[model samples]
Each structure stands twice: as structure tokens, then as C-alpha cells.
Target chain A: MAGEIKCNNCGLDNKPGAILCEVCSEPLEVTVGASVPIIASSSAAHTPASAVGIIGRACGLVVGGNVIDREFELPKDDFGFTIGRTDLDQGIIPDVDLTKFAEKVKIGQDVGYTVSRKQAIIIRRMGRLYLRAIGGAKTMIKPQNTDWKELLKDQEEEILVGSRFRFGGSEGYVIFEVV
Target chain B: MQVELTLGQRYLPITDEAEVIFLLRLLRDSQKQSADLALDLRKILDRSGSMDEPADGGLTRIQALKAAVNESLSLLRQGKDRLCIVVFDDTMKVILDPTIVGDINAIKKLIDGVRTGGSTNLSNPLRYTLEDVKPMDGSLPKIIIFTDGNVNAPSAAAEERACLELARQANRLGIPFAVFGTGIDYNEKFLKNMAEVAGHGSYFEHVKQVGAMRLRLEDEMENLKSVQDLDVRIGITAEPVVEILEAFKYVPQQLALPVSGKIVKDEFPGLDVRGQAYLIKTKVHAGKAVGDFKIATIALSWQGVAGAGVKSMNVVVNFTADEKLISPVDKTVRNTVLNTEGTKATLSGQYNRAQTLFTTSGNTGMAKKVETLAKSDEDAKRTLRTVTVTEANKGIIGKKGAK
Candidate 1:
């Protein structure tokens, strides 16, 4: 009953049991009980190890010297994901909650780490991943094998394996690497 | 009617000058015919508890606001112009949909029926207006929002951001949003930020009396009527070494600066009315070796309201630099910069800095500075008149709510 579905209008893949395409929001016509042939055939062609390998790489954040740590597996189907603190009233619930790493911070107070409600975003475009700063606070990125820090604003920079980026100009940073 | 567009400086010697500031002024030979304009005007009136307080001559603030709205409605061309009215407190009620201005009596009656009571929720009504206007085609769109208190529900910061984002969306759709803050209690920064982000809009602060508020509304209505083009965008393509530090439109409206060097181009949006001007401050990092180079090209594209097709114009600034040839000081550009800087300082509650800048620039008198302080920061005004820096600091320490 669970399988990938393709939107005929925009050609975007929808997750298993999705009634509409996530990207285009077009309704899918298939019945809920029916199985998708394309997904079944694709899974049949791949071995279990290859299937595991096909799972997307992950990016994670470490806050307060191991006070809190979490990782999110980047969506293989989507082009990008946003990381920020969540605010339900504003209808902004970022894909990755950076504040989940905070241990004892109050809701509206500066988390001592200074993370913004809407911070940096990671985008995968043109066969490469990029990190961009979209918030008011300062965000800095440091790639592997380089000690220099490059501050990001509304501009985008390439994010590669072993890349490190900090939000809100704090010591806490998130590392992106293949798992 | 003929309109002439000109730049402040066509050539400059860039020696030792890190930043170049200039003005772009638009002038018209004669006023164009206003009979053909088809405009959609939407007004959002605040019905919060504060509006019930008596303002001038025993009339409530809401009553004064209604009178102003009625006067402005009388100015609209009945058959050609469409109007919508929305009143909001913690909740919003759409009193009139986009109706032709022909039914002036009905509109006046509805305006009289707007009563005041609840807390303030500024963002939701704006969102509602956006939704109402988004799908409409072809009429010049404008929204006027009047509020007398801070955004009370859903938190102040969140609502401010939401309003700003709504303004940005409205700007992209060529809809100008003018905001009026009636009293000192309203958040001027929030209202100003909304106006700036809205691009083709103005923010007016009426702190003195209800009659002043009515006059401000009348002036804005006149401005809206005079708009020849609804959306005018100026695009600046600068050299890699050049960076635009700040930009301002009519009456010190600030444009957002580009955040990175990769952004080689930026656009400043405004309404294209006759006698309007735009000022920009840009810095060129022409390190050591510079002889003669073209710095930037400013291009303007606009949608004329009078059935004119999209019009475009371009101006280029070329610079020649040496260790000896320095650029001459331009007074208009200097005064503009000073005005913008003083306004910015006053907004940030640094009254002394604003006073010094305004005094040195000779553009603003001490009385004007005091008036600005009275509207923006009462504490800063008190510091300006009575208290020294040390006394102010001691007062801040002594009182818990001094800020």
C-alpha cells in the first residue's frame, strides 16, 4: 500500500500513501489500497545494501558541549531543507529544529546560543549542496581542511562532506557529512 | 505632458572618495490628466480600545478617523475608483468589499458604524486585505492601514515580521501599502519597517492632534491621486568593487541594502510621481590602481498608469581617478545623506547624535529635532531638554522602567 507516486503535472515524486504531490500539491488519482508498480519494480531491482546506500546523507548539530545532539537525514527527493527554531503562531516550523539542542532555555529568551527562529538553509542544486544564511543573525561556515571562516548573508556557498557551519555566531555548529 | 529624468552627477573623480552619493530627480512640465485613472483603494481602520479615547473637541479618535476617511472618500472619482473598508480590533470585519465609489452614502454609513473595543491585531487584517486584492486584475492597488497601538495578539515581534512579509508580497504585486501611526503609543519602527518593505509606500506619524491626523490622511490621499505610475523600480548594476551602502526615496524611506558582494545588482522600488527623487550612497573599493573606469549603470523600469507601456531609462556614471584629482562636494547629495543619517539616528533613540548631525548639516533646526524626538522617543526628548548624560544614566539605574 506504501509506494512512490509521480505527479503527472510537475513530474515530482510523492512519498508513499501521499494523496498529493508535495512539490506541486497536485492530487494523486490512485486509490489508497492500490500498490504502485514503479516503486515495487524499483525496489525489486535494488539489493538491500544498495537500497541502504541510496538513503540520503545526514547533517547534524551539536549544542552546549554535548548538552543536546541530534541528526536529520536529508531528504533525497527534495532540493533543500531549512534549519531554525520553531514558531507555531508564525506558521514557521523549520525542517530541522536547532533549538531542540538547547537543554534549559526558555521559549523566547536568548537560548544563550543566540539561535534565530529562522536561520540557515541547506540547498541541493545543480549536483551540489549549498548552505545559505536567511536570518538576521550572523552565520559562518568553515569547510574541511580550512581554518578560515566565511560569513554568509543572503548569498550561498558550497557545502561539502565534513563541512561545518555555525548559526547565530555561537560556538555551537552543525556538521554535514555522509553517513 | 513631458517628463524629464536626470541624474545628479554624470562624471566623478574618484580619488580618496570611498563612497559616491547621488540623486535622481523626476520632473514634469505640466500635470497630466487624472481623469483616466482606475484605482482600487482599500482602507484598514483600527477599532482598538485606545481609539475610543476622546481626542480633540470631545470627539473620539475613531470619530476623527471616520471624518478623515469620509473626506478622502469624497475626493475619489465615483465611477472610476473602487473602495474597500476593513475594521479590526482583535478580530477583523470586512464592512465593504471592493465596491465602486458611487455608493458614497452607504460607505459613509458603514464608516459611522465602526465601533471600538478589543485588543489590537494588526497583521491578520493586512493578510486579509492581501488575499482580497491578490486576484484582482488591472486597477492600481493601494492599501492604507491606520493603527494607534502596538500589535497585541500573537506577540509583537511575530506580528511585525508577518506584516513586513505581507508588505513585501504586496510590493511585488505592485500594491503600495501606506501606514499611519496616530499616537506615540504605536510602534513607529514597526510601522516604518512595513512602509520601507512595501516599497511604493509612505509612513506618516501624527502625534499632535486628531486634526493633524486628518490633514496627514488628506495629504496621503492627494499623493495617491497624483501617482502616475503604480510601480517604479530602479535597477543598479555596479562593478564588483562597488557596494551600495544605503538608498532612500521621498522623505527618508530607506531601501534594504544588499547583504553580499555576489549581489552585483539591486533594485529600489517607488512610485513614479512628478518631482519625486531617489538618493543612493555607494562605496567603491578602488584600491591603489585606478585611472578611468565605468562605475555603474542605473536603469529604471515602470508601469505607467495612463495606458502607457512599460517605460525604461538608463544612466551611466563614469569615474576618472588619480592621486591628485578629487571629486567636488555635491551639496544636494550631502544634505540628503545628512537627513537620512539624522533620521536613522533618531529612530535608534540616539537623540544627541541626531541633534549633532542635524546641527552640523544645517539641514534641520533644533526645533525640528525636538519635534522628531517628541514623536519617536519621549525619554530621549527629556534627556535633550533637561538631563545631562550622567543624570540620564543615573535615572536609568534608579528607575526600573526607564527605557
Candidate 2:
């Protein structure tokens, strides 16, 4: 068997080729390019920044706010990234912390408060980049030179490089691009 | 009629689950011109109460529909092209039987006064249109139904079965049947399936706006006049153990066509000048033998004024152990298979799956194209699904415009 595959989320060793971790249920392998959990959100005690296990080409989120985690990497076996404003009481931190970019530039306010605890998820299904929005303030795509369109709740929309995604029409918007 | 077959890969995999893809293109030898067509067109409108709701620009759906119908009536050639109108709700009624398009004012008045009532029921109208397409002047027979709600006459199942069976009858009778779903609540799957079974037909659209519906109707008429007047039933007969699996259409439009009973109807005037193709994927049990094996046969039978004829061809595949002996895969066939699967995934609301499939098949263009479609209304997606994909099972999916 391939050496004990460690779960990125729970750090438990899972059997080789097991799709999910035996303890945390986080994905154990990169299935369809959308790997598993790299790090939890900044909700509870930060699980040490060393926990981020980037396994492939990483992308960066460019936003106008107090800088935090701009470079987003995926653990080879990570399932997907859960992004939101408040993961504080949720116990688990999201892969991409929207609050990280919420600090107001001048006033120094946590503008991420406008987003829900679980605003949306960016996952790879069948080798494609997909965004599934589920927050109260529905996510909308602000395309270059095109009118902003809403991403229906629970329905997946294709996300491409250079696409600007506004979460809940808040100041915390993400422009995902391959760096 | 003629059929041409192209294979994605000439060699089959040795042991694993093997897929054999064959691209079958259908063609018509007739040189009929657009000027020679004496057209016969039918319109089936749903007068269910929902259609009376206000649409764009303060116009109710029925008013928009009447204006659209009147606009279509003006496009007719007075004494040359013929037309008919069928209005239905819980009960069915052919407001205008098959008639010439000269009396435009009377027809417009009749269309304007179409009262909205009851729920949607399609079976009766489908059956009535099938019976009314008589005196088959040899003009291409096409029936299009516009509805904004679910079938609720007696039962949804009964209505669906009646319409589907009637659609099959339309295929046999050389009548092209199409359905346009105008609202969000209409059953997308049922309408899509109905159009598929109808062979030479199409389904879907947000028929609320008068302009969109007008263009659609005009396009349909122009296509009817330009393409060859023929109806065809294309079926595949394979060895019992050899699975005749799903297919993806390539030439005419990129669509996933899941087949059943090894049969799919393709009415003539299909993809006319551009041609039509369905890349059929099949699973075959092959030994390590390095030789050619004929596994399936394609049968196509068609009837028209020129004459009726049947064409059949055997699908053959070669098995080889030598890696160098395998022929390079046909990119057209490969992309069709993948893009079709991508379209299916998109229809099922799996955008990433579709994108991955498209990218894998080297169809990055299609991958980018679907993103825009992804953000559009349900009506847009449904239109793409039924119009392009349903034609694979059985529908007359022609080019965007007449040649």
C-alpha cells in the first residue's frame, strides 16, 4: 500500500486510495482536480498556518482590503474550498477566509461581517472550476464589461480565470486568477 | 438518402471496458430548391391561465402570442404556403384547421380573441394535429406547440404518453413536431423527451417576448422551405451482447443524445447543406485478436416525392495488440463525444463536469461558451438542451437558417 495518506483536515492517517479520511471525512485524494481541505477558516483557533498542504498549481485571490491569505493553494487530496465571512462560532475554518480581506483599508473595520458564515464553495467537479453559492446574500459574477449576474443559490456556475465574484454584494469581492 | 460512418478510433482496448464510437452522417441527394417548396405549417398554442399573465412591455403572454402568430401569418405566401392553428387548455380545439394563409385579417382576429382558461393538456392537441396533417401535399409537414404549464388533463402520465406516442406517429407520418416551453414551471424533462420521441421536432424557449417567438417561427418556416422534403427513421441493430450505448451529435449541433431501443428518428432536410452526424458509443467484448470484426449495422429508411429508399451499413472495428498499429483517433469524432457529454452535464446543472469534459476533449471554446450560459435564466439552458440535444433521439434539428 502507498505510505499512510494523511488527512489534511484532521491529520489522521487513512488507507491508501481511500477516497475520504477515516476521521474527518475530508477527501483523501484529488478527485477531478478539486482536492480536499487544506486549512480551516479563521473561525476557531487558527490550526497553525503550517497545516496548508498545497499539492498542485495554486491560484491567488486579488481583492481590495487589508491583505491576509492572497495565495490560495489546494492540498492534493482536498475536496474543495469553503469561503465565508464568519467561521468564528462554526468551529471549522473555511479554506478561503473571506474575512481575511474584510479589514477596511482606511477605517480598519471588519467588513467581512456582511457575508454569512458559509457563503459559498469553490470546487472542482469533473476537472472544471465551479462555484456553488448558498449564502443569504447570493453571489454574483461581475464580468469584465458585462452586467453582473446572480449565481442562483445551490446551483453551480462555471468560474474562470479573471472572473470577479462578488459575495453578497459586499466590499469583499474576489477576483480569482492563476498566478 | 445516404449515410456515412466514421470511427473515432479504429482499434478497441484489449481488456478494460471498451468504447467504440462511430460518427454516422446522414445526407439527402435531392436537389430541391427553396423556391419549389409549398409549405404546410401548424401551430399548437396553450391557452392555460398562466399564459394570460403579463409578459414584457405590459403585454400578456396570450397577446404576445397572438401578435407573434399574426407576424408569422404575414410571412406566409398567401396562396402558396398553408397554415393551421390549434389552441388548447384542459380541452383541445383546432381554432383554424389546415388552411391557406391569404385571409390574414380573419386569422389575426381569431388569434386575438383566443381566451385563456383551465390548465395545460397536450395529448388531445397532439393527436388532433396528427390527424389534421392530411392531404399531405408533400410539403414538409411541421407542427410546433407553445405551452407555459404542465400537462394536467386526466393525468400528466396519460397526457405525456399520448403526446409522445403521437410524436412517434408524427415521425412515421413525416410530420415534424416541436414544443416550446415558455415559463419556469413547465416540466423541462417531459417536453424535452416529447421532442426527442417526435423524431423531426424541437423543444424549449422562454416564449414570453413577442420578438423572440416571431424570429423562432420565421426561422422554422424558412427552414421548412429550404430543406429537402423527407421523413426518415434511422435505427441500429447490433449483436445482442454488444451494447448500443449513448451518442453525441457533432455536425449539425453539439448535443448529447442518449438513445433507447437502438432507434433515433432523423427527418430529412436535417442539417441540409452542413450535413448531420451522431457519434454513437458502443461497448464490445473483444479478444486479443488482431483482426477486423463487424459488430453493428445502421439502417435508414426514408420516404419522399423523389422516392422511398433504404440504406444500411455494417460497423466494423479492428482489434490490435501492437500499439503502433492503432490508427490515430479522429478529432472530430472525439470532440463530438466529449462535447456532447459536456452538454449533458451542463443540462443536468453540472457546470464543472461539463467544463472538464470540454477541456479534456480540447474544446476550450465550448468550455468558455457554457460559462455565459451558466449565468443565464433556466429558459436559455432548456432551449439549448431540447433544441440541440433532443434532435439526437428524434427531431428535425436543422441549421440556424435555411440555405
Candidate 3:
């Protein structure tokens, strides 16, 4: 009974020694007994001989354009990560680098704007992944067999395999695939 | 004012549930012994061109509005309430300065003389009420705007933004900006957002019927008389791992959660007496181990009627989680979540989703779910014989062609 912790947000009582809230997925700060084991299994926990198995167990993004083609491997960390262009002077290095494409292109009389500096963010919660738009730019997500949904700024949607996303008003698209 | 706080659930089972809803009911003790609070009330009545069109029965829309305003005016305490009347069409006109409610003849004369003709311009009267009318010392200042048409001038988007901004400003100044939309032609979304931003106000929908409209206004006036406190704010302090998903205020409106807070402090505004309830959805991380833990402490602060100093109350809940103990879900909390979520889905035009949630929960009665859905969806009305067209017209009626 001493191990049980109540969630402050939803007022739901949780079993003693829970690290994350059962209801809201919030982190529980209560200490657990020594016998309690952490439920989450990370890639770092693998033995040295099987460490190579975690190499390609990640989601990747492919950005293709008329003259540009690039690939970026998403972080395997459980936490949420940002995807945008890098700003070295400001010490801003995004999880998925797109700095090479963050420029205004001019070909004859046509002009084009690049993806924003803080374009989109992918968050993993309770083993589920979600994508959110940042910097007020429009981000559209198209899941397989579903129409594209405009991911409004700050609105998060779950990402699935075969899902594609485009940022701003640009023509380049990023396909989400497990590699 | 005395405050009583109760939570819908005190125990939750440890599981992988993504969201938990806790319903907080704030009940104000009877204040019959206290004298009526002094109030500075202003009424903004719309007299647009459409007001001349015939409503249900033979009465025009303006005629119905005038009748309702007159009946509601009689309910205000004569000496304690000071009233101002403003009429608007394409522009706003101040027909009466601040006058005592005891002067029924003068008020009635102005109400009878209100004429209908011109495009609907909602921003002018709202701007005037906020900028020109100064608040009386020790008296609650409130502006009630009644309109029956969409705001058509100065561009709809610009007008909506201005109205919302004004509502926010009025809220900061402790002025309640209530808007009443009559008939099906008005922009309910704009009015609802305006009332919500005003913090301590609400948006009311009145069917075009004159008799029902009068009764609704009278009921609103009666409710206004029971104001024990105004402009109430509740501050919640939670542990680092807890996340608040939503906060709802019955007096003002409902708010989707995570409600703009940093790590330690989350604030919910626009609360009032007359028994308001807030359903909060939160998540608590199961930590490394289970032990007795302090979840959250809620501090509610409000200004009592009659210019009483700000009063505060603190409610703290603590629980211990043990794997051996089986925790039954709280039905009251569960029902509240179902109802709130159902209503939210209906308002957002997700009728099928709302119905699916209702059916899956099975905790809420089918009749109640149908009634809730019928409040916003016309299609749902076909299944419920008791639901009237007017009742079904309560929610946002987007633009002419919008879904």
C-alpha cells in the first residue's frame, strides 16, 4: 500500500512503484521497492554479441526533390525528437538534419521557399509514435489508404509505416518507413 | 462565499490507459443571508435587417427579442442594478445611459422604440462597451450581447478576432461579456469563443420562438442573481510526471487540456459559483516503485460578491498504489468523462466518432447520448422523436455551406 501513487493530473490512483502513469502516460516520481523492475526495454540493454540487431530497427525519412535527394535515420531514443534544418551559429542541431535544403532556390523567374528551421517533431509515447508540426508552418501527413491530413501547428498525429509527410508549401515529401 | 470541492474519483488502477478523467465539482453554499450585490449591467441588442423577418408565429425577430429583454429586465433588483441599453445594426447607438433599474418606464420606452434595419455589425457595440463604459466602484460590470445574425461587416475573420481580443480584455478587467445568439442564422462559434475568452461569461442559444426566448432570458437573469463569486481562477500544482490533458468550466466554457502550462503550475480561469464542475484528464507515470505519493494540490481563488476580498481554498489528495489491491473504477468520473468527451466530439463535427464512443462506453444511457448528439447534429434528431428542431440548433452553425 505504501508504494501506490495517485496521479495529480487525473486523480487516478496508481499501483505502487510505477514509473509512468497508467492513465495519462505521465512520469510518476514515486520510488519503487528494490524488487520492482523497469518495464521499458531499451536497445542499450542488448548484450554485446546481439548489439548489431538494434542497428536498423529505426524509422527513416526520405526527402526527394527535383534536384535533391537525401535520407535521414530517426533516433532510436524513446523520447520525442525534432526534425529541421541545423543552425550552427545558434547551436541548434536537429535530430533529423535537413540543413542542406534550407535555402531559397531561384531558377530563372521562379522562386521557392525551403522547409522551416523548426519544421516538425516526432514523439514516442508509451511505445507509440506521433508527429507534430512546429514553427506555424503547415505539415501534411498521409497514412497508407488514407487521405492527407494537415497537421496544424502543435497538433500531433500518430505516424504509421507507408505514411508520407510534406512540410510548408514545398513539393518535397518524406516517407516514413521502418528500416 | 463558502466553497465545497469534491472529486469524482480517488482511486485508479495501474494500467496502460492513455487518459484518466477526474471530475471536480465546486458547489457554493447558499448566500440568501447576503444582500443583493450591486451590478452595472449593459444590454447590447441587435436590430439588423433580418430582425424584421417573421420568426415562429407572427412575431418578427426584433419583437421577440424586445419582449425577452423586457421580461429579463424586470427580474433585476431595482435599486441595486444599473443598466445601459445599446442597439446595433450596421452601427451601434447608445439609446440610454447608465440608469437605475427602478426606472422601468424609461427602460421600457427605449426597449419599445428599438427599430430594425441594416447589416449586422457586431464589433462596434462590443468595442464601445469595452472602451467607453467605465466600471463602477465595488460593482460587477457585465455586458450581455444579444444578436440573431452573422457579423457581416469589417470582414468576418477580422470581426471575430477583434471580438475575441475585446473579450479577453474585458476578462482581464473583471468584466463578464456574455453573448446570447437567437435563431439559427447567427455565428454560434464566434459568440461561443467570445464568451469563453471573456473568462467568466457564457454563450446562450435561444430558439426563435418568442415564448421560449422570454423564458430563457428570464432564467438567465435568475441565474445571474445567484452569483456568489466572479472571475474565479483555480491553480493546480502537480508532480513532474503528471500531465493535465484538459480543463472544463461550466460557467464560462470547456477547454481542451494541457491548457498552456509549464512544468509545475497549471492555471484554469473563468470559474463562477452556481455549481460549476471541471473534468480534468490527466496521466501519471507509473514510477520505478510504488509508495504513498502526493499527486496534486488545487488552490481556488475568487472575488466574492459585494466587493469582498479575494478568498482562497486548497484541496489536496494523496493515494497509495499497491499491486495486490484491486481498484474499481469510479463510475461518476467515468460517466463525466463520457459525457464531456461525447459533447466535445459532437461540437467538433465528429458525430460518428461521438456515437461510437457512446456505444462503446455503454455506461451512459442511450437516451442521454442521443440527446447530447441531437444538440449539434441534425441527423441525430431523426432517431429521437422528443428532440425539437430548436433544441438541435444549439451548437455552432458554421458558414452557409460548411459542414
lDDT tens digits, residue span B1-403, model 2:
3454666556543432345666676644434433256777888898988987877657888888888778877778888877888899999788888997788999888888799999888888888778845755646667888888889788888888888888788767756665676767788778766766765534344443443577568656655555542555667776654677666554333444556665543444343433465667676655443478766887777554456666677777776666565555554454455556666777778877777765665444345545555666765565445332422221111122210
Give the root-mean-square deviation of each candidate in angstroms: 26.5, 15.7, 22.2
Per-residue error (Å), model 1, residue B290: 6.6
Error of 3 at A51 (Å): 65
Candidate 3 per-residue lDDT over residues A1-179, each given as its tens digit? 34357886677777532333578644344421111111212113322323222233355555451213335544232224466765432223455666655556554686644665567776542234567775444578876568888987546776655556766455443444434
Deviation in Å, model 1, residue B264 alpha carbon:
7.5
Q: Lowest lDDT 10-mer window, candidate 2 chain A?
A: A33-42
State the lDDT of candidate 2 residue by residue for A1-179, as single tens digits. 22245787788765322333457544443222211111211123433323433223455555562223447653222134466664321122344667755434323542324555556766542234456775545577644446668877445665554445666445444555432
Instruction: State residue B53's C-alpha deviation in candidate 3, in Å.
Output: 1.3
> Which CAPRI quality tier does the interface of model 2 achieve?
incorrect
Candidate 3 lDDT over B1-403, as tens digits, reads: 3333433333334443223344454444433332345767788888989888776547888887787777767767888877888999888899888776787877888899999878888778888877887777656677878788888876777877777888888877767765666556777667766776775544444343543456555545545555555556666655556666557543333444346552222232222223454556566554532334344556566555445334333333334345444333443344335545555565665655556544433322332445353564332332221121111211111000000
Can you tell me the CAPRI class of model 3?
incorrect
After the best TM-score superposition of candidate 3, give how far the Cα of residue B330 lies from its true spot, in angstroms.
Answer: 1.4
Model 1 misplaced regions, further than 4 Å:
A1-179, B1-18, B28-35, B133-136, B154-165, B202-207, B251-256, B259-275, B287-291, B305-327, B371-403
Each candidate's B-chain TM-score, in sequence, is 0.77, 0.80, 0.80
Candidate 1 CAPRI assessment class: incorrect
Candidate 1 local Cα displacement, residue B9, angstroms: 7.4
